[model samples]
Target: MKRSLEFFPVQLFAVIMGLSGLTIAFAKAWHFLNINYFEAIYKVLLLLDTILFFVVFMTYIFKWIKYPEAVKKEFNHPVKSSFAAAISISFLLISIAYYDYAPSVSIIFWWVGAPLHLFFTYKVMKFWIEHKFEVGHINPAWFIPIVGNVLIPVVGVDAQPEMVNIFFYAIGIFFWLVLFTIVIYRMIFHNPLGKRLLPTFFILIAPPAVGFISYFRITFGLIDTDSLFLYFIALFIFVLLLTMFRQFIKLQFFISWWAYTFPMAALTIATILMDSAYDTNLTYYGALFLLAVTTLLVAYVTYKTFIAINNHKICIPEEE
Candidate 1:
């Protein structure tokens, strides 16, 4: 029993954030479908998300208290520590969903989450500068901390001060461009991502997708040409990444595949939001197509997760 009590790594919180976001996206898609049962699934998934937050949050808290070295290991790891940002993003996503029905609870979480998120971002940036890591060190995962800040405004408009949301949004967009340039440069001049990290390339799609949604929400539903530009940029990179599907399939499965889920879901949600805001028929069809694709992909990940667990492929100490 004590052996079983060992905490799972905090990095695994990425799975919770990804699943919660996907659940919310599914709810939104169902709404677009005009499914009478949409509200039922939406609420059920929101409850599921809340339960997950508590479970994972407590699990990691146990690690923080019992296994200080584990936390140190992650924090010092150049690649792994940034994933800690997932915890903050998880809170933000849940707070966004929570605001739909419980404004007070949502506001409390947002106030707490936004500062923690920026602090985490600051630490990661500090680490990067101190280490003086070069362009060759860049990866899709680098975006996790920065991109998450921009995501704040998704719920910040209702939960945080306007200027606070704008500040983070500006930081998010600026670093997104800076990091994108470096990541693209590294990919062109260096060797390809190893199998374990290749799935993270899908992360390339997330910034612009989430950016589109955050921009729309923060601008109070403005759908200008700049908005269209953002959406298309996401759409283009999403297609660009799809070309690697076969390469990804040929590689063995790893937990990093979870990296693929949220971006797909984000793009799906962006499609639905674009359609609703612009009332464009083409975007409506596009939203349906993206939703179908996201559903199928998530189902596959779920099937593989159970199989991986039975095989004892997960739930083990990870290599640095």
Candidate 2:
């Protein structure tokens, strides 16, 4: 009760991220495949995602009020600080999910999420500049802030001017390149990620996948050499991760496992978009395969999450 409220984690917002991404992925599948069941599933998930956003947001709000120090500690934390952007990313994901069904409400979320995400980007970049973080502190989760920037254009193309969307798109793509190098370098030169953080390796798939989707949105669905490169880069990473499946399967679950969901959703959506543009059997079947995987992974993670909650495994003191 009160203890749980005090221990409520900001990272819990990633659940909304996973759920919102699943909703949008299904919505895209319905649009492309015209599958009747996809529509109902997406609609239900959207409503549930909306409800969960407020629940997690309000819980963190109370936690912030009661334990400002805890909130501040997370904000200053090298790894946890990256997840603060998940709160803004959740809002943006909901905006994209609602764009078709409720544009008016979607714009309101975009308006709030866009600016807040920019603020987080600035705050995090500033933190990195001011603090003396070791290479050991870097991980794929660092991509979270950068990924949110490119995502702006998914709905921003219609909600705001083209230049505004491009502004965000540029920031996202550029930083993604910079950070990708850093993360890869860290992995090659330093120790491998710990068990709890290993799942965040999946985040490596997000920036390029989201970049592909955002690029098409900014260009009004104009497929070109650059767009193909972005999509393929993401696809290659997805395949690379599959080769490591045995490694991932052996690890114990952590809240960070939610990191697996949204990026797969982004890549699934990108594959669907490529199918829509090129009308190829390869992309079409690829999209469906990825969609199924994303759905199953999200469901499994959600089930594990609830079990952890019920067992009081979550919202307890952090493991050393």
Candidate 3:
């Protein structure tokens, strides 16, 4: 097999998912801002995302067909296989993105993604139970499937059985805490993460943000004490990661860095939801501040990525 095609990793799916999800998140933010051109911006994003999504999807399908052994290696690796959930998550977000445009169509994608996500959750957790435990190997990627559970309700409440969606929500909320504790413990006691994996630490910002957004959706947009808890927790994590900016900036750019994008988008979207629902002056400004920060970070990442790609720096097999 040619090196270029062989170098593609299933984890690269994260890029499409993260970028598409960010587009949707920013779409919501612009709508909230009553931007005059929000519709055009959103439609363009949806179009671009649709094209990229299918191209990557087909590329992966071909990889699996042509290189089954390589696929097996990735699936067997504890850390890499956890990323398979990103495929389903991408489907879920694609479903959500199209939810309003053609709800019946969206339901089809949701069903397709949701069942696969359930299976992924089972497979990954089973590996943990059946394999030898290692504290150091734990990474935020473990939270990917669990976070998808929490996120199911965000769109599932509209597309599927309410009980099923609520079940997903409960699972997400429970394990998010469980995994957060273990991951944080590992981070504090273990050596620093490898440079390439450093961007994934930003994933810590996501669960609370997504959980807060899901809580708002489940409650049908009511404000309450739990809302306060989720929002404040997300805010704290955002600030915590922000304070460690030097660590992120010093690291060389890589596709994994795109992992940092959607979490911030989730954080931004959470604040926007709070602002609209709670009618708080602070939340109003807070949303814009987070928006600015997320926008700048994403822009910088995109710019560096373009530079890297032009220089052929991103296609390295070791990094993938």
**Once model 2 is optimally superposed onto the true structure by TM-score, how far is the C-alpha of residue 251 displaced, in angstroms?**
0.9
* Prediction 1 global C-alpha lDDT: 0.80
Q: Which one is best on lDDT?
A: 2
Best by TM-score: 2
By TM-score: ranked, best first: 2, 3, 1
Q: Whole-model lDDT, candidate 3?
A: 0.79
Task: Estimate every model's Cα lDDT from 0 to 1.
Answer: 0.80, 0.90, 0.79
Error of 1 at 301 (Å): 1.4
Residue-wise C-alpha lDDT for candidate 2, range 1-320, written one tens digit per residue? 22366567777888888888889999998897667789889999999999999989988988899889989988999999999999899889999999868999999999999999999999999999999998899999899876679999999988888889999999999999999999999999999988999988888888999999999999988889999999889989989999999999998878988989989998999998898887788988988999999999999999999998887878877764
TM-score of model 1 vs. true structure: 0.93
Model 3, position 115, has a per-residue lDDT of 89
Question: Alpha carbon lDDT of residue 237, candidate 3?
Answer: 80
lDDT (10s digit) by residue, model 3, range 1-320: 12466556877787776776667666776667665575676677777777878888898888888878877777777678778788888888887777645678778888988888998888888878888867867888889977778878878888767788789989988999999999899899998778878898888888888888888888888768987787788789878888998998898877778888888888888888887876677888888787777777777877887887778765356633
Off by over 4 Å in 2: 1-3
